[model samples]
Target: MTTFVSIGSLTGSIHPSLSGVLTKRKTVLNCPIHGDYEAEGIYLGSILKTQTKCPQCEEDQREAREAVEAVMRQEAIKKEVEERVAKSRVPLEYRTKSFDSFRVLNAEQGKALELSKRFVRGWEKAKAGGYGLLFLGSCGTGKTHLACSIVAALIANHQFLFPKYYRTSEIFSAVRKSYVPGSQTSEDEVLNYFSGIELLVIDEVGVQKGSDAERRILFSILDTRMTSNKPTILLSNLSAEGLCSLLGDRLYDRVRSKCVPALFVGQSMRKPATPDLFD
Candidate 1:
């Protein structure tokens, strides 16, 4: 059982069996809100020092510490995501694009916005199914805008998704550079890097010369990604037929199998700045 004992002006409770070995004391202390309470004091070899901590106060301190730790953990995750975004190589101009900032000037733009948001909302399902999107239309039609928005949303919300954004020309350029004499990188290395990304967005698809070499380079990356069930986004100014010719029958079939077309039709959002001659 338990027994309560008084040591000078303090009171403490201990089991009778521990009376000889353990020295425990308690002092009557007044808490601002809890009123009078007994503060437990323990004596080792030195004089006993009373710790005036109320039970309720300790609980409050514990909760505060937990809240601080939670905030710190959130900050760490945010930092990690930011670093990954930096390494993603998103173009500086499109880095700030998001669904909220996309302009909805026409019915098609509105539909495109809704589709992009749904894609982000169903990211897990899309990733599992190897589904992707094709942003097709004329240049300045906000194709790249929506593409970057999708990538930005995924990176911000899904920490596990690693996304890469590059122009079709950039990929071709990288592959060509890899062939230079004494080049540190190889063509296979370049293709493998593009193929291994969880999500890849290739912009300006039809800008490159339709050389057989370019076609082969594009085909190799797409084929590998398709086989691995990785999702891809292609931003292009070509019509459906035009893009089909560029990708050829076999490669186009693979893209159509997993990618949904988000047609962005309308005037280019870019407007030339009028000159202020008088100024």
Candidate 2:
């Protein structure tokens, strides 16, 4: 036979199968915030102990813990992106540039901004097709600003992407230095480094003297990138006709085949909006 006894808010049971072992009780426990709830209490001899918790409060606490963990994960990702951007070799002046920071003064600038964003959004497809961008216009037209913005966006979105930024003059300078006697680096080493980058941005494209040797060096680097199905961004102040003349037909055609031109037009951003006091 089984026996039951009521004590305070607890109802306890003693079963014949466990006569001298222990007893079980159903007890009502009060929660300050959630009011009273029923819980199971265990008895060893005369001592009764209950494991009590408010189900709703436990659920809320669990959700809060998950929310905190989620925020920490996001912060970690942001920090990683900042570290990678710092190491990406983007110039100090342009490292902080982003699509949101780009100022669109006119419709053309607005179109340019949108195009840059679309390129980032479709980067996987662009990378697969070896497609890139050509930022053209006169100086101070935000060409480099938009280019760096693209690089920054890519770095943030793609964990493993390798991006490099260099001026047209720097490329020639590096290769020229490699030709010096007793130089540790070779010409092929310099060329191969530029060629192997996952994404390459060459700024000031038409700044170099249009010599046959310069053209050859540029051709070798661009041709290798094309063959590897890698993309290259070209930033130049030269008009389309002038750029075509500088690059000559062969290299110009190679660039046109894979690049979507975003022509930025307007006065120089470096120019002040208001008239100078002396003017």
Candidate 3:
């Protein structure tokens, strides 16, 4: 026969054989471990349901919720950053952009992006390793558009750690100005910014003249990134030969080693890039 008893340690069903003795001993059968005593009590779930909650399960749920919240927060931040990047890009007004209205149109621009993606993807394969690409062609060949599109994609699709876009002269000048006498900024800060980025797109390369001093600073930035294995995107109007003439051997060879040059050959895409021209 089963008997129920309320005693010191027993709060639920108690076997008749042990009930009287356990009651006299101030111990109960089927008693759930209370809050503090939960760890010490040996009770089944059926009895413990009336006692204290399972702390282990409670802790697990809390952790799981926190993890889910963390993931959601990260995804939100990533989306925000991508939107900002897309907005900050140069408007299609100044140029005919193949990446804007049509990224996969006739699959031509898509093919270009795909070729570029192969290099960028390599960096991801190596835990963010690999170098950059130098897109050299005449103006209106969609070099800048492709370069900016890459920055957009890396920020949008790839979730690259931190991507930055700039004209070659802008960053080169910034680094140089920082080293001038009484300047508030330092060279280290410039290098730190360039070095830390996961991907850097430098457009209009060879468009500006660099003093020997500026050349040295430019080399410093490129060499540092190369050694650290950060990828860079170079868009320039200069031919491979012309680039070698302008940047000199050191920078040339370094860029040459890291990048696969894609020569854009076609009539100027800018002459008539609008739908109106087709009419």
Off by over 4 Å in 2: 1-26, 41-50, 271-279
Error of 3 at 257 (Å): 2.2
How do the residues 1-279 of candidate 3 rate in per-residue lDDT, one tens digit apiece?
223343455435876433332221112333243333232232232243233346666687899999999999999987776565755444445223335543343344456667766754565753355567888877776677677665655555555356677777778878878879999889899878876667777788778775676567667777788778878777888889988877788879988888767776554666545888768
lDDT of 1: 0.84
Candidate with the greatest lDDT versus the true structure? 2
What is the TM-score of each predicted model, taking all chains together? 0.78, 0.82, 0.59
lDDT of 1 by residue, 22-139 (tens): 3466777788987877787665323554455898888889999999999999999878866776678787787777888888989988988898889889889888988889888887
Tell me the RMSD of model 2 versus the true structure. Answer: 6.1
Model 2, residue pairs in steric clash: none
Where is model 2 poorest over a 10-residue stretch in terms of lDDT?
1-10
Worst 10 residues of 3 by lDDT: 20-29
Clashes of 3: 1
Q: What value of lDDT does candidate 2 attain over all alpha carbons?
A: 0.85
lDDT of model 3 at residue 49? 27
